[model samples]
Target: MSQQVQAVIAPGENEPVRVETIIVPDPGPGEAVVRIQACGVCHTDLHYKQGGISDAYPFLLGHEAAGVVESVGDGVTDVAPGDFVILNWRAVCGQCRACLRGRPWYCFDTHNARQRMTLASTGQELTPALGIGAFAEKTLVAAGQCTKVDPEVSPAVAGLLGCGVMAGIGAAINTGQVGRGDSVAVIGCGGVGDAAIVGSRLAGASKIVAVDIDDRKLETAKSMGATHTVNSKETDPVEAIRSLTGGFGADVVIDAVGRPQTYRQAFYARDLAGTVVLVGVPTPDMKLELPLLDVFGRGGSLKSAWYGDCLPSRDFPMLVDLHQQGRLDLGAFVTETIGLGDIEQAFGRMHGGDVLRSVVVF
Candidate 1:
């Protein structure tokens, strides 16, 4: 049977999201219905509202989420009812070439619920953001998208592992391969960059430098384990990063801001054979230029950290356990909790730079 539930929706391009009644269908084979508990407000959601991601209007806009599985369809042996889980956008298909090669994290064919949620009023199918939209009271998703985790952890904190948090930490450990005694400089003090700091600290980095225009964010980065803070607005970030690392630059430099200028800084800010990780999202129109000789001479890897090169099944549960053991503080990423209706204001707070994350708690 289908069910009617209240959900937030972007009705059109650049349209302000408003509450609407959506019809969620019963799970089909290989699908599950989740009663969402907490969903984080992320910049990607904002980009969806502005039509930056696609022309697919009326997007169901929430991806970073956690919930309880209310039910699962036939053939879904992995997850059963009453299980606590964090929703992930990547639902890997094992038969893909990448998966067959034992690199499922790079699975080319990720998926979502086969059924579509529709507007109760007009029955128009709504596009689920990242295929795991959880801004609603409940959402249907493919069974593979739900990764069971420790129920003891707060749903609010667990939800963060779904996206930005995972991306940042993955960028550091998985993509950049940060290790003990390594030096890391994260360019950007937002939630993602801050997570990179935490990851570096966990990996036993000897020094962690945070570069950002805002002092407040830099301070937050410091509290999260940054050993040095550089106000890029005042100083030449590339030079400062080198100075902080004893003039050799860091072993790994991550650009969480993803802009041409920041990328250039990252390119030049690393040691002669140091790695540069780009985790920040950039617009399509943006272009980058660097001397061909420099690219060839850098001698190290330049990587774009896609969802932090994370494998959801492996990383999510491990991170949850880490948090439970107090080795990871996932709660710090959540600045405040608000009701679903407050998402609009939460978006405002996000842009105002007053909050790291404003989570919608159901």
Candidate 2:
């Protein structure tokens, strides 16, 4: 049976997102239907609305979500009805070259529901934001997209593990490989940057410096485990970071802001043979200019982290357990909770830097 539910949709480029009736069809082979309990308002959703992601219009936006499994199609043995799960965009196909090489996290072929969700009034197929359209009351997705976790955790916090939170943490722990006593500097104290601080602390980093223009966000970074904060507006962050690390740049510098200037800051703010991780998404028109000699002289890796090189099956459950044990503070990331119709308002708040995350709770 096809279920008609209220969902948020971006009808066209630069159009405001609004709630409308949409038809979610029954799961086909290797698919599942989820009743979403909570979904976070991420910048990626905003990018989709602005047509920065693709030409796909009338996008069903929202991907960072947690919910209960309502039903499953044939051969969907990983999850069943009534199970609690976190929605993920990466659904690894074991036969892919990346997966066969034992790096399933880089799986080239990810799974999404074959069936399309259509607008109720127009009968037009709606493109999902990132293969998972989760702003709706109920959503259809690939069975592999559902990662089961303990039902005891709050859906708002757990949903974040699906996207930005995971990306930030993974940038520090998985991609940057922050180790004990290492000095780490994260540029941009947004949700992603703050998560890098927390992840660095969790990995036993001795000096964690956070750089951002907003003093309020810097304060929040301290609460998330930053040992020092640098207001980039007041001082040169590269010099500040170097001064804090005994006048030798940090062992690892992560650029979360993803602009040309920040990228250069991150490049120059690392010690010789130190790693620089670029986790920030850059615009297509942006061009980077670096000295070829410096690239050779730096002598360390310059890597771009895709989804933080994360393996969902391994990271999600472990992080949830850490949250349960009270070792990780997942709740700190959620600043507020809004309703389905309030996505536009939440986007404005995000743009204004008033909140880290404004989750929509069902």
- Lowest-sum lDDT 10-residue window in model 1: 49-58
What TM-score quantifies how close candidate 1 is to the native fold? Answer: 0.99
Give me the candidate number with maximum lDDT.
2
lDDT of 1 by residue, 1-362 (tens): 98999999988998789999999999999999999999999989999988989988789999999999999999999999999999999999999999999999989999899999999999999999999779999999999999999898999999999999999999999999999999999999999999999999999999999999999999999999999999998999999999988898899999999999999999999998899999999999999999999999977999999899999989999999899889999999989999988888888899989999999999
Reference-based TM-score of each model: 0.99, 0.99
Clashing pairs in 1: none
For 1-362, candidate 2 gives per-residue lDDT tens digits of 99999999999999999999999999999999999999999999999999889988999999999999999999999999999999999999999999999999889999899999999999999999899999999999999999999999999999999999999999999999999999999999889998889899999999999999999999999999999999999999999999999999999999999999999999999999999999999989999999999999988989888888889899999999999999999999999999999999999999999999999999
How far residue 282's Cα lies from its native spot in candidate 2, in Å, is 0.6
Q: Name every residue pair that clashes in candidate 2.
A: none
